[model samples]
Target: GWARLADDPKALARLPTVAPGATEELDLHLSLETRLAEATAGETLTHGDLYPFNVLLTPDRVVVVDWPHAWIGPAHADLVMLLSSVALSGIDPEPFAVRHPLLTGVEPEAVDVLISAQAGFLLAIACSVDSTADPRLVRMMTELGRSSLRWLSTRTRSSGRSKSKG
Candidate 1:
């Protein structure tokens, strides 16, 4: 479902208007579908939801508990989700995310696509007229969507990557 919306050109194009202040994200969508096709094609079982609530800490090692959204996607997808949850706490997690052992050797564009996809999907849900979702749920989606876009903006700018609309 999220992937469908993410790869839709109409959905990507609507992101700027759906997410306030996300106009610059319009440029970030360049090649997103192509890159995602490669990055997300993997055998790894990423959690798809890796927030603290689903994680456990043991003296010996860390553990992940949730599996409902698990998928055969890039390992870095979980890392991106983890970092996104961290960002919601008002802390910037990019610096640590980039160098984290999990994301080691992962392409920069791979990470960018996940952020873009999630941002687009989340914002779309919040803006959807058919959404009978609660106001609180809608608000949460909107906040997380905006947060994801901000994270994307920071990552793209730091990497000196931006595509001008053709």
Candidate 2:
């Protein structure tokens, strides 16, 4: 379900260039920072890396596999990562939510936040893995990373307004 981008080369070339300090990078860094800070304060549970491949399913049973990246932090962090991966892979997340009742009560916007965070993390990992040498995966990571940054920026702005109102 992972959709490959046509502009993979361009996208891969953009990853390392994307970072916090750049004006375009602020929103993502802010959202990640906020979530990380909240996680540090015990606001959420962390499951380092969660993706569909790590999920095992059978009729009437569902199991979460892989624990290497597991940690205690924000639950949203895991959720975001899952959502982003789903989007990147060109899969509809709605079916996943329907099949997994635990996701039912989560707000759509929160899911968006989770996707952003997840995408950013994945991008960072992909970029770090010598992505420059692998053009296809590099492009996928780059495009996904860009989407993640945009999502983070939106979430940051919305949260900022909410805090100001309160």
- The runs of at least 3 residues in candidate 1 whose Cα sits more than 4 Å from the true structure, single-residue gaps closed, are 1-18, 56-66, 129-131
**What is candidate 2's lDDT per residue for 1-166, written digit by digit as tens?**
0111113554345455653322344343444444533333335556666767778899999888888887775455566667656655655544564466545665555554455445555565554565346777666656666555555445546555342221
Best-performing candidate as measured by lDDT: 1
Candidate 1 structure quality by residue, lDDT tens digits, 52-103? 7789999999888978888898767888977877787888989888679988
Scored by TM-score, the top model is 1
Query: All predictions: root-mean-square deviation over Cα?
Result: 3.9, 8.0
* Residue 112 lDDT, candidate 2, scale 0-100: 48
Residue pairs with colliding backbones in model 1 are: none
Clashes (backbone N, CA, C under 3 Å), per candidate, total 0, 11
The lDDT per prediction is 0.72, 0.52
